[model samples]
Every structure is written in structure tokens, then in C-alpha cells.
Target: MTGDIAFGAGWQKTIRVGRDYISVKLDDPSFAASVYASLAETDNGDYALIWSR
Candidate 1:
């Protein structure tokens, strides 16, 4: 699956990492590089956003 995130006046693209997570690539004109992150559901039924350097 794929989607878009609204940032300011523009949109960023996102994709599904697996059956359990949705990944998003974040980028900006002022940033040096793009950042990747993923969101997954927790055991308690809440969602968690996971990222690494």
C-alpha cells in the first residue's frame, strides 16, 4: 500500500513495510538527506512510531 503525508503546503509519500508496519520517507529542501521511519501496532492496541539513526 501507498499514501501521502501533508506537510505545510506539500505532500510526502509513504509505503507499507510489511503486514505489521507502514513506512514513510521524510524529506525537505533544507535537509541534507531523507529520513525513514515506520509505524506499528503495539500489544495494547496502540501504535508506535519507530526510527533509527
Candidate 2:
């Protein structure tokens, strides 16, 4: 579970196992639209998504 698209920021409850096993489940249409806004470079030199509020 590298990329985590959770409702809130956490490691326990929102722990992502794997992409094949767990894809981000955002059923909330409004929340979904807000979460997927843009992409940005992470400090780890890898790419990650920038979710909007």
C-alpha cells in the first residue's frame, strides 16, 4: 500500500495494504472530486497526488 487515498490522515484505521488488494475507495462523489485535484513531487523524490479540501 504505497499510495493511500484515505478520507483522513492516519496509519492504523486507514492503513493501505496494497494496490491489488486495496484501491482508494472514495464513494462520496463530492469528496472524491475534492480529493483528486493535482499532482506534486514528494520530498522522497517520488510522485504523489495532491488532494484538495
Candidate 3:
């Protein structure tokens, strides 16, 4: 799946990691390179956005 950032310039595309976390690739024209991140569930039922190198 693909989605645009709310009130932001960039967009995100879902990536299949075959794990419990939700992986995505983010990109924008101003960015030098695409960023990869994952949303992992926290103990409080919230999600944390973890940036990957």
C-alpha cells in the first residue's frame, strides 16, 4: 500500500518484511535518499517509528 503524509510533502510505501512490524519506505523530492522505517507495537498499545540505516 501507498500513502501521502498528512499536510506534509513526502509519501510512504508499504514494504513486506514478513515480520510482526509494519515496514515502509519514505521518499520526497527534497530527500537525498529514501528512508526506511518500521512501526513496532509498544507495551502501551502505541506504535513507535523506528528508523533504519
What TM-score quantifies how close candidate 1 is to the native fold?
0.55
lDDT of 2 by residue, 1-53 (tens): 58855463322122244221122323355553543333444558776654445
Alpha-carbon TM-score of each model against the true structure: 0.55, 0.26, 0.54
What does candidate 1's lDDT look like per residue over 1-53, in tens digits?
Answer: 88995532322344365345666667677667767677777779998877653
Residue 15, model 2, lDDT: 26
> Which regions in candidate 3 have their CA more than 4 angstroms from the true location?
1-19
The lDDT of model 2 is: 0.40
Candidates sorted by TM-score, best first: 1, 3, 2
Best TM-score goes to which candidate?
1
Best by lDDT: 3
Cα lDDT of all candidates, in order? 0.62, 0.40, 0.65
- Scored against the true structure, residue 15 in model 1 reaches a CA lDDT of 38
Once fitted onto the true fold, the runs of candidate 1 whose alpha carbons sit more than 4 angstroms away are: 1-18
Write down the lDDT that model 1 would get.
0.62
